[model samples]
Target: MSEEPTTPKELSVRSLTGLILSAGLAVVGLFILPVFRSFGLAFRPAFWLVLAIEAVALAGVVISVLTLHRQRTLD
Candidate 1:
């Protein structure tokens, strides 16, 4: 049996979807953090900074997914 993905297009689509979901969840977390503060979760300025970093990471995942999708399409 081959180890490499035989259907790269499908893989790309799945990866893209996962990345989008991850990014969406991260965005939701960013918004919910403040709300959590009302429950004594402690919404510090550094937390916002961490959220910004998470957003960037999610963006990177999205970029990677797009790149993979494009490469699969070109193939």
Candidate 2:
């Protein structure tokens, strides 16, 4: 029996960027945010900081999806 060949598709740059941003933000937010709070940046400021990180990550994912769709359409 012959095995069928499978073609591998490369991930788009936007998608990779999204993944990196999401991961980096999560790591930084998890590790660094507490330190900032401990250093005296109390509730509201720290809350806003977390919100900003979440917004950026969400935007990255949205842009990545849009770019991927556009790229596929072009291909």
Best by lDDT: 2
* Tens-digit per-residue lDDT, 1-75, candidate 2: 999975555568777777787767766765667876898999789878887887787787677766653322435
Model 1 C-alpha lDDT per residue in residues 1-75, reported as the tens digit of each score: 868867544456666677777777777666676566766666586477557767776776777576655444553
Which ten-residue region of model 1 has the weakest summed lDDT? Answer: 66-75
Q: Global CA lDDT of candidate 1, please?
A: 0.66
Root-mean-square deviation of each candidate, in angstroms? 8.9, 4.9
TM-score of 2: 0.60
